[model samples]
Target: MTEPIRISRTGSVETWTINRPESGNAITGKDVIAAFEAAAEGANADIAVRAVILTGEGKIFSAGGNVKEMADRQGMFGLDPIEQRWAYVDGIQRIPRALGRLEVPIIAAVNGAAVGAGCDLAMMCDIRIASERASFAESFVALGLIPGDGGSWFLQRAIGYERAAEMTFTGDRIDAPTALAWGLVSRVVPHDELVSTATELAERIAQNPSHSLRMAKRLLLESRTGTLESTLAMAAAMQPLAHADAEHQQRIARWRSS
Candidate 1:
């Protein structure tokens, strides 16, 4: 049986690929939870892995959910339609929360179409790099649903409230160039070079001090929801530990010698 997700590593960069290409790489609710769990565990346990790259196996990154599975589940349970849909929402919404808590940086290599929850997944990552052929859409509204997978949070933070509202309301698809212009992705590259460019960026990040990188990620996450005064206090508490690290000392000594 084929795995829903595939993991590989290149040096300190771990790559997780969504393997269901026949479905436009769509992820089921179960798949989203499982993928996030596996990726988070792998990144946390391996000291050698300083960064992670998320992508999809074939032509598309992800089309979002497995609609056929949804249909089958509804048929099997014969449950109230609203209740069944809520179950689906609960399962898939955990993915972004898991990604957000990861200690290391994540780079989404958007190879093709990323719609609905798929677009949320990409936006949750620390950085996104897209291929020329990549497209994105906040497609939930068109289906009479809302962004359930933390899309509202990440999208609003990424491109601001107006743009997020526009995309979510219209469910309009945006190409890579427009995505970049709208600050959805960090950069766009040719289709053939997407993986290479993303990998290169990951490698560059991995070369930095891993502990410091993790701490910086924590600080950045904290700053998002923390009040200015609280953030300042947190930073003050963290500063001494950062300065006391052996890596920090070594850099200081080197600077003094120069």
Candidate 2:
């Protein structure tokens, strides 16, 4: 079988593409966990890899979970409810864990529809850039399911509680422009330019010193749950190390000279 996620390097940037377009890139069976693990491994293995761009092949970014599996009571939904609950704990739940552990910044290039868990996956990233054709929905309710993969948490952070509640309750689709207006995505580009636009953004970020980039990302993640005072203290602790790094001194000199 082919890899569900494919990782490639261009300079300091790593691109991870979801390759299961045939099934609309659905997170079915083990693919969701497998793909996320690959991302974590790829990012960790290469010290030179500075940034990551995640996009899906073909039209849809992802349709979320496998509808067929859900309906047929196969795959992750197999056996009894108790078993399925454990399946979730051991299966798709790993995606968020793997992704959350990645120190480097991640960019999600949503090329098309990202519904249900798919939208949550994009939200897991540090930044999101969507194609004009892209749409998003917290669509678990539509299928009589809740976002068991941290969508509730991610959605509220991305678009706020009011809008996230609206999307979650209604499971309505938000087009790219609306998504941008809601601050769900940083920008929306033409459909054909999605990958290129994301790549350009990743390359720009990759140009930064790798250690600093990772530290900055960690600081942002810490800010999500930390108090202002706590965040400030953490930053104070980290700042000295950043200042002491040779790369920091070199960049400072370059900046002053230029």
Off by over 4 Å in 2: none
Q: Write the per-residue lDDT of candidate 1 for residues 1-258, one digit (tens) a residue.
A: 577889888888999998888877776547657877877977887767889999999988998876675567543135587876776556776677678778999999999999988998898899999999999999998878788777899898999899999999999999999999999998999999999999999999998767778888888989989999988898898888888888788878988999
Which number leads on lDDT?
Answer: 2
The C-alpha local distance difference test score for the whole of candidate 1 amounts to: 0.85
User: What's the CA error at residue 131 for candidate 1, in Å?
Assistant: 0.5
Clashing pairs in 1: none
Per-structure clash totals for the candidates: 0, 0
lDDT (0 to 1) per candidate: 0.85, 0.90
lDDT of 2 at 207: 90
Model 1 TM-score, 2 decimals: 0.91
Give lDDT: candidate 2, residue 169. Answer: 99
What TM-score fits each model?
A: 0.91, 0.96
Q: List, residue by residue over 28-115, the lDDT tens digit for candidate 2.
A: 5586578788779779777799999998888999888988878887776767889888888888888888998898889999999998
Number of the top-ranking candidate, with TM-score as the measure: 2
RMSD in Å for all candidates: 2.2, 1.2
